[model samples]
Target: MEEHCLFYLAALAIFILMLVMTFFISSLLQTPPRRHKTASLPLPPGLQPLSVLGTFFALFRRSEFDVEPLLRRLHSRHGPVVSFRLLSFPRPPIFVSDRVLAHRALVGRGATFADRPSAIDPGLIISSNRHNVTGAPYGPVWRALRRNLATKVLHPSQLRVYSPARRQVLDVLLKDLETKSSGGAAAVVVMESFRFAVFSLLAFMCFGERLDDEKIRRIASLQRELLSNFVSFSVFAVYPKITKLLFRSRWKKLLDFRSKQEETYVPLIDARRNLLLRRQRSEDGFVYSYVDSLVDLEIPEDGGRKLKDGEIVSLCSEFLSAGTDTTATALQWIMANLVKRPDIQTKLYEEIERVVEKDAVVREEDLQWMPYLKAVVLEGLRRHPPGHFVLPHTVTEEVEFEGYRIPKGAVVTFSVAEIGWDGAVWTEPMEFRPERFLEGGEGEGVDITGVQEIRMMPFGVGRRICPAMGLALLHLEYFVANLVKEFEWMPAADGEEIDLTEKVEFTVVMKTPLKARIVPRKRT
Candidate 1:
């Protein structure tokens, strides 16, 4: 009787798979009547043009979680811009690796390509039904959210108001590293320290107060849990009405995680609201926070109602995760590279020493006079962008791009790492050479925003570019400068060299977390 039940379950799964495959194939084979004459143009080239079955199987064979390798192969086979579809997907996702084409689509026709794809079940649930900035559609709500962050929180003047928080976090990081390093007698793994430090800083900025270590750790764990399982949760996004029943366990787990996240975050949101109502400031004075902005914001598109607790939680989650993971990942890669190449480290240290006083911490303003420091940060971003691909974008309407027709609602993405490594733009793009950005170098005067031409874009480009770009750059420059100034990073005492091999997590990070023997710099 048990064996019969097992067989029936297996059969049901197979039948469901076949049904999904058939539905996708029929959709691909069916041609809808054209609404415009431009619709006659050919679609971008794809990997398997022979049949829909071939394309489905080809995509199935590739790892669904890691699409970089598949995208590279597709681009090599079919020029820079290519499209691929998996079973049950509504549209063929187009990928562009060519810089010129990326510029044309993302910048030249910025507004047309500014919109994001429809949010899936997990994203919708976590983002409070697509109310947050990242998941919100490109329109009035998106504009309001993005503007609030840019003008109220992330603006330069606003960022400077948080200097005390930055210094406090820096001191905490230094103390933690000092304890772990044990006066240069011990080797330390720095990624955890990097992550916690950044998380603490962002938490302070989010909550308007410095949270206790336990609270910070709890928040960090919850955010990391979401990011670690984010890729696996994609399964629930497909055919959600059916997947919720088929994968009931996973669906339950996602719901439980969201519940825990809300439990952890809502209290802080309420505290901020209460503080605002009391109209009182702590002894340190009123420090504006991201949540404060969210709480006070009135969405004109949504009948001018203020954000609810759940929506605030979602935005705060985005703020903590985005700022923490990406910045920490970049920090690890930069420090690891410095460990591997001491010559470059020495050059950077000398530059820092020249600009900063002896025994003094590297300040945000000092970052400007140090050109070599800027080059090193730029090199780190180019050599190891935290994310290999930007968030997927969709076209607002059917449009002609690069002599091919992109239908309305088609999913579009760009190969960020590939564009930054384009050989035509940078000489020996694979090498970690900061001189490439120095005067008389090939990469000098290169714009990372992809405005004039996309030599490299670590934070993406165009109208929908990362609103936190300025703040992120400041964090990188400030932290990298101080870290190099604080210690001379060296390979671990075990005689093993620093491993730069990357592993993709929430962001692409060093496979082997950077283990370095850090000797405190003896400044005058």
Candidate 2:
């Protein structure tokens, strides 16, 4: 009787504890926004103070309202720069739409403004903050990874080396489009088709081997799944102590999704490790790809000198996420926009036709003489910058700005989309004008090489800018040149109106995928 009573008591105690934790989590996730800490004052005039719930609901509605349009409205109400909550974090990001502040945040400020904030919910964990190059804290590790990426994968010389794969992927894409067009499938969502093309190019670059079409598609799907979940509330939920206990199911899904992603990545990684053992380093020569470079990379970890398999997998996930979607989505948006405006499409088509003629293959080197080709891509990036905010930056040091004190670990972010479309910088901010980048305009002084004063940073900027930018552009230029040369893309049987509504999944993409009718322009 005594034992039974004690057991019941302990069980009841645990039940009460769990009940309290669940309630705590629910309330924590439901934290009021205005109660959150924000920089005092500097609140742009006439802006209503946003509560935690208001900020959450506002951004939560973006999938419906779209990021750009929603931000535009917010900018109007809050003026250029304003404070808003992200996820459920008490301290929301200060979205800087003011170009001056944006420039200062991205390029002007030193590491003080660029580092990841410790208080930001998901970012405190070493894994969320450190595992990969992009998430790596703004420090030595970031530099090492950036150096490796710049030298090995994104160097101009390295880009020159992969020209063959670019040509091959374009050829495969055109062949697939030709077959699809002939099959009377109405139209292929050439945007996704473009993604497949970019994927093939990047996968080959990353894995150093050709993946079968089905395998590539499977990988793309997994990547999209991983990306969709990455920056979501699940990660942030894990940070809040109360929600951490309550949202166990959602958190488990994030882990499961991550594990599922690893399911796709591990096989490729293992295969490459095996390839490294059997394959000879030939002088004639077997080109070392990104995976090969990573294989050779050695990073110090807890007294061991080599990167662990898990770390390598994580880094590869970052690589796949950064390189694939940015390139593929940019290509999709560009193609869709061009289809909408036939005049631009016609000029682009004529330019490619002028050079490539009947040959469906457009080489990377071939893009050199076509300034219009470069402009079209520039316009694409400018018009539809992939990420609206360049991954929330954190201040690592106490800094003073605009008569306000910014303490250490404040989450800072610049409105990347807003800056490019700012009326002060470019005329007709909303217009898709490739002409802005012609011979001696904004793009003339622009460095296609990346890593300079980022005029249009779809790839981001500073020490943490994407290492795959060069390869992404090569993929874009090579494939876009070929695809346009092959097909005069038009809207589906529905007519010229292509749905441009944006959806933020992996990257900002057409909510309705670009399904277009392809009238073959080049001789099959």
Candidate 3:
């Protein structure tokens, strides 16, 4: 057994060595593109531009999953806009932390920086060759996908149609919490419940029907499996042809996961298709779903053909994923803060009481009148935006900004968390003060869309901003208001204080999942 173990270790070491050699050779063979003589702008300040090995070692020092600290350090040391190369990629990727530069790049020069970098194998395969909105290159296909979502589903009027679904999910969540809390006798770990509830809501929106607990749990489990192993799958993205062969088990796992996803989602897509077919005959009690939109969408860029089943599966997967983990993560952070700061919780509850009548559930219409609820939600997003960085964006053509020449096809990412926490823009940025967003506060009249200027963009900004931003805000406000109004959230009795320490997953979640004592609020 010892001999066999030694033999396997030797084989692994040899494989790694060969992989490094291959990278080195590729790096040497790739020639740098010549810049136009008229456009001799320097690249952003970064590590020694010519040192491929140094760049590799620098990236090696930081875990790919948690690069926030490394990026923070780089921004502090080299100023806001930093650039560095990775492996054999032709151009160095730029990381922008300054809000001003972010505005200029993402808003002012929006078109130039709207394109997405070419996807690696995992992204390409999972997105069905960039068929989904988030993964598609900035082109006709992206426009079509995004327009469908924004117009047919995410538009404010369309979102109002899902209020009943939201209320039903909220009831389930309250029941689950009430059961676990046991009249404040027990402390409940709420992240899983939050995640499951949000997934259930999104699943309903995606499939246009109420899924049973078993099916919702099954689908959520599959998605959680994918997210949990996402970083591990990155191994298959690098030098995929070789790594897929070398990491055979991981490759098989990726394929198996995709197969399972297709198996699960295709039936739902077909069901929606069948519903569409029947709608022509009897248009009775039909609610339009996200899948229905995808089923009917014809991409002008793709020869006007309707989306294939694989693409629909991918689109539905994107819809569930984009809405589920991020919103659930935000809910956990917001509720955790409420538990930690009873004063704020009390203030928010008072506002809810003033707006919502006793014995009546908080309604979507009631949310519009609750200013403090919006403030609390905004503060949660500002302090703990789900993603620390936006998805990497690429340049459509060479452009110059802030004296740096951004080459075409170069990857650029903005620091969403860092920008939100900018001390210059936010007062006592680290503290959770919802009052800042109230009237006569620093955050008053702040536009999250970044149209005028980017004070704090939790949902991002500019053309590529999250299309579902309105829906997400509505969910947050409605859920937070109802949760606070129904229960008094307090620190767990088990001596576990609310810990705000963060850990990176699919989103930045509480390092310690929130376990809070909940007492049902009395009504007069």
Query: Each model's C-alpha lDDT?
Result: 0.86, 0.69, 0.85
Q: Return the lDDT, model 3, position 319.
A: 90
TM-score of 3: 0.94
Query: What's the count of clashing pairs in each model shown?
Result: 0, 3, 0
| Model 2 per-residue lDDT tens digits across residues 318-364 | 77667777888888898888789889989988887788757546666
Q: After superposition, how far is residue 522 of candidate 1 from its true place, in Å?
A: 2.4
Q: What's the ranking of the predictions by TM-score, best on top?
A: 3, 1, 2
For model 1, the run of ten residues with the poorest summed lDDT: 56-65
Among the numbered candidates, top lDDT falls to 1
Candidate 2 residue spans exceeding 4 A from truth: 1-74, 77-79, 85-92, 118-129, 183-185, 231-241, 277-279, 283-285, 300-304, 440-444, 447-455, 522-524
Q: Write the per-residue lDDT of candidate 3 for residues 137-208, one digit (tens) a residue.
A: 998889999999999999888887788899999999999999999988898899888988889989988988
Candidate 3: what lDDT? 0.85
Q: For every model shown, what is its TM-score relative to the native structure? A: 0.94, 0.82, 0.94
Q: Please tell me which predicted candidate would have the highest TM-score against the true structure.
A: 3
Among residues 3 or more apart in sequence or in different chains, the pairs in candidate 2 whose N, CA or C atoms overlap within 3 Å are 25-242, 33-51, 33-52
